[model samples]
Target: MEPPRRKASFLASMKAVFWSFFGVRKRRDYEDDAVNLNPVQVIVAALLGVAILIGVLLFLVKMAVSQ
Candidate 1:
């Protein structure tokens, strides 16, 4: 009988994804994430992070242009 996989929490997954976006992570952390993180949660987190980054950049550009 196979044991069920223990999924990491959403917050943990998001934190992992955030660090990934910043291009920084320890090898030990990456190994742990590979075992615990859910693929769907990671994808969602990555998308949300990208969207927020883009939104912030756009807002800053607009503010600069308006001045």
Candidate 2:
């Protein structure tokens, strides 16, 4: 009999999110993440990532317009 698998940690989920944002994940890594990552964590991470991206873009645009 096999032992039960451990749940992925929040930090692991964040690492997965970062790799996804860059759009360059390996197939093996993707497969591993798919099995380990929690849906709720992924959703939260994605929302946070999008918000950060928007904030950065806004900051850059504001700086460009000011100059």
Candidate 3:
């Protein structure tokens, strides 16, 4: 039988997704994340992170243009 899955906090899920965005995760960390995180959390965090990144870039461009 499979072991019970540990539910990681939202913050931890976000951190894992953030590191994944940069493609800089250690093997051990990845394995740990696999045990702690679920696909849905990762997908949601990724979408949120992408939205934030796009918003930041747009803000920067607007500021540069306004100067």
Candidate 4:
């Protein structure tokens, strides 16, 4: 009979490769203290914050324009 497939190992290997990019990250155990934000998360949050600010500004402008 043919050998069983090894799809599980392929997924494990991909996870290892993906996490290797952030080598030796410091672990944060304290729940009451500052938490480290991942780079991508920080970038995304900044973008969303900027978008919200812009939306508020535009709303204010429209109100002023209509008055």
- What TM-score does each of the candidates earn? 0.90, 0.84, 0.86, 0.47
Stretches of model 1 off by over 4 angstroms after superposition: 1-4
Pairs of residues clashing in candidate 1: none
Error at 45, model 1, angstroms: 0.6
The total number of steric clashes, by the backbone 3 Å criterion, in model 2 comes to 0
- The best candidate by lDDT is 1
lDDT per residue for candidate 2 within 1-41, as digits (tens), equals 87546499888888888888889899999998888888889
RMSD for all candidates, in order, please: 1.4, 2.8, 1.5, 13.9
Candidate 2 vs. true structure, TM-score? 0.84
lDDT tens digits, residue span 36-67, model 3: 88778888888999999999999999999999
Worst 10 residues of 1 by lDDT: 1-10
Prediction 1 global C-alpha lDDT: 0.92
TM-score of model 3 relative to the true fold? Answer: 0.86
Candidate 3 lDDT score at position 49: 93
Q: Write the per-residue lDDT of candidate 1 for residues 32-55, one digit (tens) a residue.
A: 999898889999999999999999
How far off is residue 36 in model 3, in Å? 1.1
Sort by TM-score, top down from the best: 1, 3, 2, 4
